[model samples]
Target: MEMLIVVAIIAILIAIAIPTFASSLNKARIATDEANIRAGYADVMVNVLLDDNYDAENGNASTAGQTKYYLQKDGSVATTDTNAYKTQGKNDSATTEIAGQKVGAWAKDKKVTYQYDNTKNQAVISFE
Candidate 1:
């Protein structure tokens, strides 16, 4: 009887923990996404201040520097022309090379990117 009670208690605890763990994991994902976006935005704006490659009508920035401007990603998956980034809106403009990370795991088939808005002279985030 004592062993059975222990087993039952363990099972109950596991069941309760599973959902709570899942929810916590999701919350962590959201927090990570927010942090990545904020930091990435700052990175892009800093690049703009240091870069001299802006053109009035082109809406572009340089990619030839030591660091490629994919913003948050690094290593191999960084520069691929795959779903890591979505090309739409003014992002498809020939002059602009948008830089940002994939959106949070809560979202699929989407990415967050940064581009310098020449008219406004500010870095803007775009979701695509």
Candidate 2:
């Protein structure tokens, strides 16, 4: 009888813990995704600013946890490292939209390829 009670208690504890653990895992995943996107955007912008037809190159060097960013391809392939975070929706609406530019910040991909176009013509290049 005592063993049965203990088993039931253990089962109850596991049931209560599973949902909480799952929730935490989800939150952490979302946080990591957000961080990756922001980092990707920053890297892309830095590479763009370094774009000088004379002195600096238009492409960015590959980071430790990030891919190489390029303004426009010049018949050469872009470089990429093993992205620490592999998340879905990297090429979804977030990356494909002009308003969101979410793809600009996706770190899950191998290459941060960008088409330099200011559809808004606001003169300010930002992800937000």
**What does candidate 1's lDDT look like per residue over 1-128, in tens digits?**
99999999999999999999977775665555555556666766666655676443555555413333443343112323353533211212233232443332225334666555655555565555
RMSD of each: 9.3, 9.3
Q: After superposition, how far is residue 36 of candidate 1 from its true place, in Å?
A: 2.0
lDDT of 2 by residue, 11-50 (tens): 9999999999976776675565455545555555555454
Candidate 2 residue pairs in backbone clash: 94-102, 94-103, 95-103
Which candidate has the highest lDDT of all? Answer: 1
The TM-score obtained by model 1 is 0.53
- TM-score for each model: 0.53, 0.49
Clashes of each: 0, 3
lDDT of each structure? 0.51, 0.42
Cα error of candidate 2 at position 93, Å: 12
Single out the weakest 10-residue window by summed lDDT for candidate 1: 87-96
